[model samples]
Target: MRKYIIILISVIIIAFGGFYMKHQYDKKEAELQYFNQAKEKMENYLHENYKNIKEINFSDSYSINPMGGISVEGYLNGNKAKEFYGIYDKSNDEIGVSSVDAEEKSE
Candidate 1:
């Protein structure tokens, strides 16, 4: 019957919509986890290596790089004008500081 067909189509639509929303939610949660991990690694590195760092601040935006690491940017000691960059490698559970010049901010 026509009514049965209409109901079937509506159910299909609802199922697809629910799946799409769930996918988006999962993606956002993964990104947030990565961001948090990166931030924590950077914080620990700074604390262990530096003495004058009182506070750490990170930008709201982060990206997963092609090299399978997360790149983060932030500033230290509430100095938002200066930039602090860090790369966190998930595989080794380490922060990559070789490319980052934490002592000097680029103009």
Candidate 2:
């Protein structure tokens, strides 16, 4: 009886471990997709507001906050320009640019 209980407990533990790992994999995939969408939106915004966008640069790090907000740093034509911050709605895969400022930093 004791051996049977131990085996059952082990099986339960393994099942939970598998579930947790799958959850993490799904989360990371979703985050990557969201990042790509955010980057694309930034590029579109830059093209509309600035000329010669080929020279633009952007910081490597983009913060996605717990509240689904995205903050990105970008330079226009090789010089520091407005920063972007907004919320990403997963239901629509859209980023809403809340504000663009020249000196804003990620929190």
| Deviating ranges (above 4 Å) for candidate 2 | 55-60, 74-107
TM-score between candidate 2 and the true structure: 0.65
Candidate 1 weakest ten by summed lDDT: 98-107
Over the full model, what C-alpha lDDT does candidate 1 score relative to the true structure?
0.81
Tens digits of per-residue lDDT, candidate 2, 68-101, equal 7666556555556544444555456555655544
TM-score (all chains, Cα) for each model: 0.84, 0.65
Check candidate 2 and list the clashing pairs. Answer: none
lDDT for position 92 in model 1: 93
Quickly count the clashes in candidate 2.
0
